[model samples]
Target: MTSLFDPLALGDLTLKNRLIMAPLTRMRSQQPGNVPWELNAEYYAQRASAGLIISEATQIAPLGQGYPGTPGIHTGEQVAGWRQVTDAVHRAEGLIFLQLWHVGRISHSSFHPDEGLPVAPSAVKPSGEVLIADWTMAPYETPRALETVEIPEVIAEYAAAARRAKEAGFDGVEVHGANGYLLDQFLQDGSNRRTDAYGGSIENRARLLLEVVDAVVGVWGRERVGVRLSPYGTFNDMHDSDPVALFTHVLGKLSDRGIAYVHMIEPRATSAGGGDTVQEGVPCSSELFHPLFDGVFISAGGYDRDGALEAVASGRADAIAFGRAFIANPDLPERLQKNAPLNPYDRSTFYGGDARGYTDYPALG
Candidate 1:
């Protein structure tokens, strides 16, 4: 039986264990530039025991930003800021990957350059409120559909961000195509109602994501690039007429590309008031799509130690990613290894806060 603690080959690097730190948006970057600072460095360094730490969702360009204080990889200052984080993680003997992201229709105009409307594959308004630059709730506005010619610009932005991640000294990059964000908005039929080559059929809808993946792979070879997907995700009101068909095609395409790994968000994570419960009768991404992906497969969302062990041992997933658990337990791997009780995380300081909840979680003595 494969143990979660066993070393596994993930692309060119051998992860010491299969416990990955999922990319979490803390929204604590410095204002004005949205650059990561020393505080962010300390937070990541404290979790160095994770097999791999996927940094918070980072916008690829100014227009790509959706939330206040989320970091970016587009500017020199942003790159420099991330360098501090990468350096600290490396000094702590940890490997980290920057998750390249762009939240399309998830944004309010205040976060866009020139206060322009957020862009998506179609002019659809999501059914939720977004946190604007001022941290106020604003209803999602109908986003501008991207001109066919404008898509190349989006692909280029991803490539550029991958290069910046490399310059920032990250070991690799994970394209953020999950959570009903820009790429997810393009993947599902409910949000992407386009007549052009970028939408319509499954192949067309998946075009942007694959193209973005290829572009990032160009910067960092296939071994160093991974993609995150949320097949049955309901967050941000995402849905599809045929999720299995859409994700099957997407997974098969990714397997053919031979990328490093595919990280998937289990449906249970998006459930109301989030917990470890899997929605009854909904097939898990690992159970449904794991066999389709030839390379490494990582499953995230609501996994306890026993469940993680079962998934890995049964070949349901190659690894498990922990989000909230890692927040309150910096030495989560060690704690799990010994079955030590985990410190409960404070929900109040989850987003945009100081060192109190960020780095104050005491490790096992």
Candidate 2:
């Protein structure tokens, strides 16, 4: 049986451990430009012991911005800024991947140009609020539906963002298709009520996500591309009546593409923002859909050391990605190896904060 401490091959790269760092949005990037800076570099460098680090959900364009201070990869300055982060991680012998994101309808007009409404697959207002600058909360605005012809443009944007991730010195790119983001909006039925080629049936709903994966693969090839999905997640007010069928079909399509891996959120992840919305008795774990895909599978959400070890040992997942544990324990893998006590994370400073809960969390001595 493969232990969490053993190295595993993830596409073209080999991770030293199976404790991958899930993408976490700290909202500490530089203002106005929304670029990663030296502080961001230090933040990631401290936790470089993970098997892999997936950078926080980074917007591909200005219109994709949902919250303030989240980083972007669409500009020369932003790419240059991320170079520092990649360099820091690489210096610690850590592999890093950037997560390409677009918030879709889970956004406010304040972050938009001319205060325009955010765009989505359809005009649906999510039942939640978004954080702007300085941790200010605002209700979500009804988003403008994207025109059919403009779909190709958004696909191209993902391709461009993938190229920029390479330019920023990342080892790979994970398309953020989870957490009710743009691609998830198109993937789920609740947010997507369109009559075009991009909605209605399971195949249509999955069209945008596959197109995005294809577009990014065109730039980075299949080996350096991965995708994240939340099959039973209700975050940002997202839901699909037949999540198992929907995700199985989508994962099957991704298998044909030969992507590096599929990072899936567990059903327990649905409690975010409000309460659980996943139907009872539903098969939502990644283990149920493992055979449908031909690549590595990463299971995330509320995983502890024993749980993570069991998942990999039982062949349920090839790896496990930890979120909050990683936030408080920079040397998470090391601490887990010895079963050492972990530092508690301050929830108040989770978003839009300085180095307090961002980088000052000390690793186990």
Candidate 3:
């Protein structure tokens, strides 16, 4: 039996186990630039027991900032701040990857640098709400659409961010293409209505994501790069007319490039809540996407220990990512190794908060 604790070689890095720390969006950073701090370092270091840690979604540039207090990697301060995190995690014998993010239209003027309009593939308003700096709930605002000429710059930002992540001491970098972000915004036809080199066709719509992969892989090498994609999802008003085709074409692209891994959200994974496989919003079906990606596959969303085991046992996935469960249980692999019960996460503190729910969750003796 291939246990979750088995060492697995994912590209250049060999993980101690299969339990991956999902890239969560915890809007906790210093203001002005949302630069990372010592606290961020401590939080990540504490969770170092996980086989691999994908740090919280960090904005690539100033325009990429979606929420206040979320970290940024576009500058020197943030990179220096993150070095502490990587150093700390390494000290604890952990492998960590940085998740580069751009929220696209899932933003409010309150979160923007100039408080002007936010950007997306189109000016679509997100269906649900968003939490701001004060941790106040508010409706999402309509965002300005990105012009065709502006796309190359965005792709360059992802590449530059990946370079910064590597310079900042990250083991690898995962492109945040999932959860209704900029890449998902374009992949999903419901929001992306562009009629340019970057839209209308699946190949065209996939241009940015591919370009991003090219750029990041160029800097970090294919062995140190990964990408996340969420199909059939409803978050941030994202849905594609034919997600399978869009991603299958993408699968061919990923195949050609030799990316380190593809961290995909399975049919029932959510960005929030414990990884328990909840069926909601088209269920993010991955049956169509699985066959396409021929790399180290790490599936997350909603998966408990047993479900994760099933995924690997059935030969469907190589590894599994645990979000909330890993959040509450720092020594998650050890707990699962010993078949210990996990501590329940406090939902109220899932967003912006201190160490209470962030790092205060105890590791069993």
lDDT of each: 0.92, 0.89, 0.83
Q: After superposition, how far is residue 235 of candidate 3 from its true place, in Å?
A: 1.1
Better of 2 and 3 by TM-score: 2
Q: Which regions of candidate 1 are displaced past 4 Å?
A: 113-115, 271-278
RMSD in angstroms between candidate 2 and the native structure over all alpha carbons: 2.0
Instruction: List model 3 lDDT by residue over 267-329, tens digit each.
Output: 565544433448765544445566777788888877888888887777677788988887788
**Predicted candidate 2 versus true structure: per-residue lDDT over 1-365, tens digit per residue:** 98888898988889999999999988899877998999999999999999999999999988888888899999999999999999999999999999999988877777765848999999999986778644688888889999999999999999999999999999999999999999999999999999999999999999999999999999999999999988888778888888888998999999999999999888776654233233446455777788789999998887878989999998899999988888889999999999999887777887787999988888876
TM-score of each: 0.98, 0.96, 0.94
TM-score of candidate 3 on Cα atoms, chains taken together: 0.94
The total number of steric clashes, by the backbone 3 Å criterion, in model 2 comes to 0
Cand. 3 Cα-lDDT: 0.83
**Can you write out model 1's per-residue Cα lDDT over 1-365, one digit (the tens) per residue?**
99999988999999999999999889899988999999999999999999999999999998898889899999999999999999999999999999999999887789875959999999999997888988999898899999999999999999999999999999999999998999999999999999999999999999999999999999999999999998889988899999999999999999999999999988877752244455756668899999999999999988888999999999999999999999999999999999999998888888897788999999999
Better of 1 and 2 by lDDT: 1
Question: Against the correct fold, how does model 2 do in TM-score?
Answer: 0.96
Highest lDDT, which number?
Answer: 1
Query: Arrange candidates by lDDT, highest first: which order?
Result: 1, 2, 3
Q: Rank candidates by TM-score, best first.
A: 1, 2, 3
